[model samples]
Target: MIRDWEKILLVYEQAVEELKIKFKSIRKEYRNTDEYSPIEFVTGRVKKISSIIEKAKKRNISIDSIEDGIEDIAGIRIMCQLVDDIHRVVSLIRDRDGKDLKIVEERDYINNMKESGYRSYHIIIKYPVHTAFGAKEILAEIQIRTLAMNFWATIEHSLNYKFKHNIPKDIKERLKTAADAAFLLDMEMSAIRDEIMDAQQIFQAKSTIVAKILRNIQYLYFSGKIEEIEDIRDRFFDLNEEGDINRLKEFNNYLEKLMDKYNIRKLI
Candidate 1:
């Protein structure tokens, strides 16, 4: 029994870590192309032994059938900036269904929220894990939600734990109200989503330009171009103070040209 539990936990842990990396890489790909990533961040966890046992007991699963009956032993959560992004992420996962993981079921709680006011899109998947023994398929769950929804759900989860899943009627009612408010916030943010995305993109582009320029400057300093570095530093400070992204980008181009002239390998 102990060995069985250890193997189960190990596989679930591996699944969680791999899924987190995969989802995070998707976000990184969008950022690398200077595009707005729908996925703001990802988090994952493998259920603890105690929690698993408790959940299985609550669900009335036989101990022998726990592995197959209890989903969410491995969980991945993707948080988005807007509700629309949640659907996009869900679509993305759907697109990769056959090649990466096979979708077992989908629960659209965002459209049809739970009675407890939980709002998230749940995707149950069978993920293949290659271990020393061989490839084993395990059930994992992915939850997608907007930031506002995540906030409310987090608070509700805490309350549920505190109340042992029997939250008082009064608190439950308040939670439902708060859930609606959170969804309203998401709607308002979605209304201005374009503006927010544009602002974020500009900030990201500026930050990238600054990083590249600084890296080049560091290369110049190390290459014994002290005087040149001083002038470049002053110009950079002036351009930064001007707070013009275009000018900063122009200065960055000039630095690239200068580096080329000096036979300095471009520092990305």
Candidate 2:
């Protein structure tokens, strides 16, 4: 049993690394550019391995022969940016593995979730794992979520752990409220992303100009132009105080009005 556990762990770790690389490549290739890294998603699976063993032992189940019956995180979740992206990612995963990969089970939690619950996608995949000792076939669970959905799920998970589902009424209500907020935030974020990207481009451009000025000033100071640097330093401080990023959005609104009046390109 100990050897089996060790073997399982070894195989599982390698599977996880392989999955991580695959996920990263998929994210990059498809430009799903949200911050959901494979490591972030796979930690739950690693933790569930021990639990799966324990549960199997209780049921007098053969660990080697177990399917979804004794598996916990043999399941995977893939959080996507959009509903369509979820399906695309799933299809990609199915097609990418050249080995003996089998799609054993699937659950579309997004369409199937109960009301007041969050959304996600789940898949069970059976894949061959090769080790120095031998080759073993195992099942893996894949879960996918949108960025906002992932955030809500992660926070809800922590809350469940902290409260153990015996949460007070008020806290439970607050969680529901927060879930609603997360949903709204997701929509708002998606809507404003293009504008944010545009602003980032402007910021990057202005920042380049600022960098050049600072470098020139530094050069002057290094060449013993202390008094001239002091003057530039004062101007630098003034600019810094004026260009505070917290105030930029307000300035952007003003720029919008000015751009409207002048019919020039808007500033961020």
Candidate 3:
């Protein structure tokens, strides 16, 4: 019989946490460099003991072999904004194979949708985790899917649970229809992905400039530059209302010089 369930679970938990941070860091890196990131967000979970036992029994996996047999005990999910982004994330994971993790298997459900209308790309990997005992390797499942695909899958999962995996035929048909609709939405979004990304970049740049301007104004307030603060604040509001990013950037630059003149440290 398998003993030390706590210890086993602790390792899985650690793996999930570490994987989440790694993927999230990738997203942060892209943003920091002012590039579009394929990864929209990441989430992870260690399977609960009860769910693990249920799955093991359902799959005829012996308790002693559960550690090796249950590939998703440590699960990480990467959400992408577009269907193309899903493949990009998979490529990223593949690039790290043999270094950070070893790919044991891959299932492209998006291209080959399950009979139940499920869609996702699954990569089963062997990830090594360092425990107090030693460096032990464990199996983890990484699922990459677009936001639309995730929404459909989430609803299907809940329905499967509620209906005990025997959803009524009518409900099943509706779910399938919804799945196709979701995929269609993904395709449409991918068609205009470039336009969408450009818009987002512009918005991000404008937001950054606005934030810096606000910070400079605040610093001026604290530095007791009361005489010049009103004019600067008025110009900021006017430039903001003009809705011209270039003008805003120029104004921000002027604020930077003003701060420099006063020797006020920039917050950003």
Candidate 4:
């Protein structure tokens, strides 16, 4: 194993990038098909070298065993809009067909939360890192949680940092209460999940259609098709007012055809 921390970090960077891309690709697949995606957003990071060394020291891990002992040097966080979506995201990750991406372990704290009142699902995966020496298996972590849980956890993290991880008893009790409140909020949201999802889907569809129309109009305007712009805009306003997605789609297709009929001189 190489002792160069920079080279090791490059591998972590690649692992983070690959996982983020995979998760985002799944999100795109759902969005393109007009379906609900469990993934609200995906983010990743490589743990700081200082944090790594401290954790390793605490665990009494020797330098040679750091690669296997520290699983979260490369980390990914997946956020969801609802609690149920957390499980869905986990399933998606587990079903991934990558020959290199293999789930090694999962720690479910949501069902049986931590004594500190933390609630999240942790996933550890073995990812193959290709180097000049050949492919080597590296461990990475994926954390999944709802938006509300994230808010609570983020605040607790900040407080822990502020007090050097020795939070006062009163503050700890209050944090426990806040975690309960966050859980209640997630449960309430789950109660109206269907309605919320339906509204979100409608909004996404409308936004996508409007964006397409505006893009086509911009191209048409650049192509000296200003004459078509005003009429399309008027119709767009009418259909949007009526919430007519079918008509909006038709208008988008019509505009695309008009934009394609640019047989005139190039403005640029």
C-alpha RMSD values across all candidates: 1.7, 10.3, 2.0, 2.8
Q: After superposition, how far is residue 126 of candidate 4 from its true place, in Å?
A: 0.2
**Residue 58 lDDT, candidate 1, scale 0-100:** 89
Q: Write down the TM-score of every candidate.
A: 0.96, 0.58, 0.93, 0.89
List the candidates ranked by TM-score, beginning with the highest: 1, 3, 4, 2
Give stretches of model 2 more than 4 Å off.
Answer: 1-4, 30-45, 48-50, 53-68, 74-79, 97-100, 188-268
Model 4: per-residue Cα lDDT over 179-245, one tens digit each: 9999999999999999989988988888888888877777776776567577777888888898888
Give the local distance difference test score of model 2. Answer: 0.61
- Residue by residue across 31-87, what tens digits does model 1's lDDT show? 877888999999999888889899889899878888899889999999999998998
Residues 1-268, candidate 2: write the lDDT tens digits.
Answer: 3445554566776776677666666555432332322222333355456666666787888865555465444444556554445666777767855554777777786777534466677777777778888887777777876777788788877887688757678877787787777767756766875665456545654565556555555555555524555765776667667876434434334434534554443222
Weakest 10 consecutive residues of candidate 4 by summed lDDT: 259-268
lDDT sort, best first = 3, 1, 4, 2
Most accurate candidate by TM-score: 1
lDDT of candidate model 4 versus the reference? 0.87
Q: 10-129, model 3: which lDDT tens digit per residue? A: 999999999999999999888766678899999999998999999999999999999988899999999999988988999999999999999999999999999988999999999999
